[model samples]
Target: MTTTAAAVAPKPTGSRTAALSFAGTLRSEWIKLRSLRSTVWCYGIVIAITVLFGILIAQTASATFASGGSLTQEDQQSYALLVSTLGIGFSQLVAAVLGVLVISGEYGTGMIRSTFTAVPKRLPALFAKAIVFGVVTFVVGLVSIFATALITAPMLPKSGITPDFGDSQFLLALVGGALYLALIGILSLAIGTIVRNSAGGIAASLGLVLVLPPVLQIIVAMTQAEWAQNLAMFLPDQAGGRLYAYAAEASVTGGVIVLDSLQGGLVMLAWVAVMFVIASVLLKRRDV
Candidate 1:
């Protein structure tokens, strides 16, 4: 048979050569995020935990009040709504889990190879995931807090816990809880990008948030070092917690978070910015 060679065509130009826009990457990321079954589970778990825990706690308190228990102060009871929203603490773990999975799961499944191929400019992908996941987590956190507060508010009266919806602390706590979780999502996503293993990312993120604070506390106690406690205050979780706090209580570790909300938020963002830069640089330099 006579041999013939087929010539390869030149690549298409203009739009075909155009890089993916940041907005397009964001929308694509959002679609991928929402499609995951874990996304649904994480949000559901957080919201359910908030509402159910609030109800159960409120009922227990009502029983105690009926049996003659009383709060130490009237104002203490007014914080009942904010108290019910303590579910955010647990919800943060779920957010961290999801955030890690957002990037690391792709790596585990080898989908990240495809992702990097699609956008050779890798940093935009990271930014898109962070923004989209952050928004999701923030909305989930906000809804969880507000739903718990609404559901528990009426029942709180039976428990001798009066909740003032108009209370400044209450409002700030709700908004702050959402903002806090959103930042957690971003921080964990950055960590996930850095670690590139779902379990490792999850563990590192949680260890940073949950494990580090108590470790600092122990160190503070053992060494009687004021700096140890002060250091704990600047931790991502600790600083994020301030967003929902009624007061900026002093920590014994070296991270002593200031009383100012703006300062605490800035501190949290500072951590996010550092990790974000690290993740971005690594993503650019490393293999998919």
Candidate 2:
């Protein structure tokens, strides 16, 4: 009798040995974002546009005044801040696209399933991505705004103008500029999470953050609605700016405003919390 050779079972091809923890997921996201070409280009553009516009506007405004025109110190300071923040509108679009890609690119490339398999708990992946995007974007915004201010300051003196960064309003505007971009970044990430489709996520984010507020402003103007105006002030963008302003003006302004800095920060935080809650629910419930 010949004995058959014993069959050997194939080694397990799939093992759960390399699961991703929250920190690991966050680190992976950071690596992915840094490795992407679009992230580099978008951030470069943001800084370039902000500085260029700040200098151009400051130079032009200074020229206009020097040509026998009049502009107050406050006006010069406010306009300088506006110039630095000019990229805010377009930068939000870049940020929204980035946010969409962070989530939707995986789906588009069929990597999302792999990601889900690695993590198993879907919400951690989403949270990790959001944290990464938010922190990176916020830091970028701060750097851009600070650099723009520094560059624009010397340029202003050439036109015989100088802004007091120590001035309450000027400081407030600077902080406001940075916070506005950060809020936009967070808002875009939320929209991206809610809408898994890249195009859909981007469109929805643009509509909600950029389009909706202006539309609401027009409506409020047409209807003369105080409530609408008040509501608009609490929007993610507005509330964030207000918080920054309040921080910058904390010592000088001192309880003069209806809503304090804490209140404004809370309002913005509430918006973020709501978006995260919705996103988490969808992430858990959806088939992704």
Candidate 3:
């Protein structure tokens, strides 16, 4: 009886095994992210889209110049910026979907129960997953966006679109494009956490990032209301789009709101912050 009691006895608080470090949790999440086939495919697609779009736009611009087209300096800058970041519009949808899958897949397969069981606190696992996903997504975005720029630069010189690598605005736009992608992915991850179902999460993610923008634009066009236009400017896609928009004189027309790159970035961060807080709260209070 005494031997059995001792064998089953709980260890003292100090002797209990230490909870897994955040670093360990991060490493585990990274492994899970990279091991998934969907992650591989989504990232591969992002790179491919960036390069292809760059090539297409570069060729189009070159041909136009060859046919006696002309552009002012501002137009040239805008055109170059467009070629560098146009892939962002298409790739962001993929990022949002991947973000949903990262968490929603675990929930679907019953793996989240195990993940929460291992972490016990739950929020750490959520944070770790977000951190890992955000970092990898950012790196992938950075590489693809910059690589496309370099690859397309030589194609543009014949058209008088010499890419000035030393241009601060140009560099910032490239970095901002990557940062926008990372934030978009994180925002979708938060939405997935809140929804907790793969289909619903993806639909909601894409709906916010994709559908809502166009719908709101239509409303603004039909109504021409200042409020509608201003509200549209705050949507995730609208604000994030400004991140890579060619820098120009900051001006607002007719009481409508216009966000500079920095303001746009802050608005996007606010969206992410609000969504993440909600997700963290729900993940903690709800049952896995």
Best by lDDT: 3
- Pick out the ten consecutive residues of candidate 3 with the lowest summed lDDT: 1-10
Clashes of each: 14, 0, 0
Please give the lDDT score at residue 227 for candidate 3. Answer: 91
Which model, 1 or 2, shows the larger TM-score? Answer: 1
Predictions ranked by TM-score, top down?
3, 1, 2
Per residue, candidate 1 scores C-alpha lDDT tens digits across 40-106 of 9988998888888877877776776755655654355445745666777788888888889999999
The residue-level lDDT of candidate 3 at 69 comes to 59
Sequence-dependent TM-score of model 1:
0.86
What RMSD, rounded to one decimal, does every model reach?
5.1, 4.8, 3.5
TM-scores vs. true structure, each candidate = 0.86, 0.82, 0.93
RMSD of 1: 5.1
Summarize candidate 3's per-residue lDDT along 1-288 as a digit string, tens digits.
355544677767986676899999999999999999999999999999998998999999987886665667667777888898899999999999999999999999999988987899998999999899999999999999999999998898789777777878888889899999999999999999999999999999999987888888899889888998899989998888888887833468989978899999999999999999999999989988
Candidate 3 C-alpha error for residue 202, in Å = 0.5
Clashing pairs in 2: none
For candidate 2, the lDDT comes to 0.74
- What candidate 1 gets wrong by more than 4 Å, as runs, is 1-15, 63-74, 247-258
